[model samples]
Target: MSNPNTPKEDDKVNALIEKCTPILKKMTFSSFMGYCGGLTAQKVGRGMAIVIGLAFFGLQGLAYNGLISVDWKKVQDSAVSAIDTNNDGTIDADDLKTYWSKLKTIMSNNLPDASGFSLGFFYGLTH
Candidate 1:
């Protein structure tokens, strides 16, 4: 007994979902990589505000995300994880210093470009 205005979880829909469950459950290489990438994006987005504030304070070195490795947790803390300027629970372009800054951060971390192999990559604190 359900109201016409309300939706019901019918067997057909459930059956369809069950049919696709196996495929979704199997994590392929692409899917696993995608999941990891998504997690990394979330981590970076959570620290967008801190990054912006750091930039304002002349800590531009934090902005450089070359191929070199750095403590992401410390970097994220600089932005203050709780500050959700975008109200999206993550520091994204909405609250970042600028759109270009956001792009730079993401690209520098995920894609090192041709310069990644160079020794200068280690020196780029703000790419």
Candidate 2:
């Protein structure tokens, strides 16, 4: 009773189901791994500790160099006029965050893909 050129509805549904089943199975496995044990939680805690330690060390080094010892009032006033791109009277962490965020975005967008040029140039520059 089906048309010669057209697939049956069950055949289409089965094809779609076949395409998605592996993806669903992989996601389920990953979720099970995430929630079934303390191992993932411990790893995340260790990673956060490492990041915090590195930030502390970097701040300490900056302090020793007098780089981060500027007067907060003057720095805030200067930063308000200088970095306030939208001219908003209030300066918040979001401004600095967005600046670095844009830098990362630009770097990623403009960066050349893995090619022989970069490797060759690095080798030439080093040697």
Give me the overall lDDT of model 1: 0.53
RMSD of each predicted structure: 18.0, 17.0
Q: Which parts of model 1 have CA positions greater than 4 angstroms off?
A: 1-24, 57-127
- Number of backbone-clashing residue pairs for each candidate, in the order shown: 4, 0
* Model 2 lDDT per residue over 3-105, tens place: 7778666787778988999865644332333233234445666899999889768877898898886455775689588987667766667776777456434
Tell me how candidate 2 scores on lDDT. Answer: 0.57
- What stretches of model 2 exceed 4 Å from their correct place? 1-35, 70-127
**C-alpha local distance difference test of each model:** 0.53, 0.57
Candidate 1: give the clashing pairs.
45-91, 50-79, 64-125, 64-126
Instruction: Highest TM-score: give the candidate number.
Output: 2
- Candidate 1: tens digits of C-alpha lDDT, residues 1-127: 6677654567587678788998657644444444454456566766997887775555445446443446667766765555556566577666755544454455455443423322222223222
